[model samples]
Target: MTTVAAPTRRRGLFATLGDIYHERTNFNFIGRSRIWLGVSSLMVAISIGALLLIGLNLGIDFEGGTQWEFSVASGNPSSTQVREALKDTPARDARILTLSNGGVRVQSSELKTADRELVTQALSNYSKVDASAISIVSVGPTWGEQVSQKALIALLFFFILISVYLTFRFEWKMALASIIAVVHDIFITIGVYALTGFEVTPATVVAILTILGFSLYDTVVVFDKIKENQSTLGREKGDSYSSMVNRSMNQVLMRSLNTSFIALLPVISLLVVGSGILGAVTLRDFSLALFVGLLVGAYSSIFVATPILVILKEREPRFRALRDRSGPSVSAVAVESVVLDEENVMPAATPNPNDQRVTPRARQSRRGKRR
Candidate 1:
């Protein structure tokens, strides 16, 4: 019976650390299945398509509109009641969203002094029970537009600077791959907002940009391992570049999981606690997007970025030259030989210098010599 060798196990923290630093063997989740990778990439592409078609549901902060938040301690107010109260107000297309702590948030396209008064009076109906419960906060459309423009400019600058930095730190190909992954995460997060019709406030922009930075950091970690593995694996015989990349991904997979888990803890807390305490709907939007982006970011770094890179690099003439220069080419040749049955019935044999002519008696003599 044939037996298989067991895989080498990594032992001790120091050994594992050494392996990570030296780009030795490790395990990765995406490395286990190409089918999963194909599905994830397709999903990302679909998300991008949706974003391009419908665009994000930009909040008043982006397109210049007024936003108001009112705190009320009444019996839980319904959306219908809030709308009816402010029905005749100057503000057009008013929206009311319920908060976790039984408070209601009111927002509108734009507001005037008269509109504010009407809103105050309508809200006063609930305030009669608890006079100090309702508080109104408002931001002008001009300020919203300026904030939006600045946020967009900041995002553009961030993308350019990060791309340049990654190119310098790793390779241009890795940098491009990282950037594409970031774009994928961004579009998916934006699509989530659009599909669910979540408000895209200033806070949402901040969260998106933060996730972009995090995604880059994760991609860089994987690429750094790939770079090291490329150098080491090149020294060994029968190790393909694709195999080296797969090995590097496996090595860094644990690190990626640990990093992602640590990062997600805070974002999850913000999503749960910030909404309860802060009474800001924007917090939920921001945290949700960040959470989703982080997950997609980790996935892209492993599957999308590295696989795409292997596909690209393998196609290059330089890599082909390297493969050829590093190894000898084989040529086909033909030779004649003889075979003997168990009863020592020998097949016909031809004499050739490259082929051994073994007679049945000679085979017995060779077996005796081995014994």
Candidate 2:
């Protein structure tokens, strides 16, 4: 008898990257879902704790204040000079920050017209800038309260509308799961903002609202795939809800990542150059909230949204029957292969999450195209 060599298959240098981009890679997302779920739960817990205890730092737009802005040829005021200017005055609690436009921003609790004029005059004289260079504006506590109320109302309405839409468009369970994911994103984003002591302005509110849409788009991409996969589900044999969900996720994973990356590119530029370098306080406040929201939004759609949906789906009578009848597929078995070294291909043991002995998605269409 002659000994024969077994031909081994080799993965190319860019095989992994190509697979991911082309929706051909197999990742055990549903198999490892519990880990991801636990991670998300822990984050939400921390965020909620921070929100209840620390609270958000509201901006002048939300809290009543008198704001004065002006330019000085000699540059902005130092903290020492700002302190000296407010010394022995009711406006001693004022905040002074430098603007990118070589101007100074002065803010304090509500001041009477006389006091406001006096404060402006003092700053003008100290900076030796023209009197006309100083501009002052007042905001009432009542108005701030109103804005806060309106924001809350808008948020409530948005939630209601989204829930109804998701319920009808997909299924009730998907709707509920999506809500949980959206909530997760919001809580984390708000918590990060609160912890950073970033001022919550109207611009920040707008950014947060915008995040809901982005999160929804990412989530819908996955859910739509899940629904499509569900159609072909019963037609084929050996398909479990877990495996189907995992397959759907893999199909849309790369598209989600690409979309998030493209969206973040401009937002990052705005934060770094427009806000940090240019010192545009408005842009800073706006960009900070958006940056956090965009990042968390992207995260929740995959890790937070799909897992919840799968768990919910597994509860249905139809899926339950299919899961009980089916076993793992050949593709599911091959999915176990993972590269160990540049040239060494290793077959990983099936994770088998259930104590009773269980297993794992086929690669699908790229970028969520219609079947």
Q: Pick by lDDT: which candidate is best?
A: 2
What are the per-residue Cα lDDT tens digits for candidate 1 across 8-52?
432556665555556453443323336655776678777777777
Candidate 1 lDDT score at position 244? 67
Alpha carbon deviation, residue 60, candidate 2 (Å): 1.9
lDDT tens digits, residue span 1-371, model 2 = 22344446667647877878888766777776788899988988998888889998787778978988877758656767866876766677797777776777788998898888788778877788877778887889998899999999988888898899999999888889888888888899899987887778899889889998899889999999989988888777777888888788888988999999999999999899988888787888888878888888888888888888877877889988887788653234426423321343454445344546334456676887569
The TM-score leader among the candidates is 2
Q: What TM-score goes with each of the models?
A: 0.73, 0.83
Q: Where is model 2 poorest over a 10-residue stretch in terms of lDDT? A: 336-345
Against the hidden true structure, what lDDT does model 1 obtain?
A: 0.70
Model 1 regions more than 4 Å off = 1-37, 49-55, 126-133, 276-282, 321-371
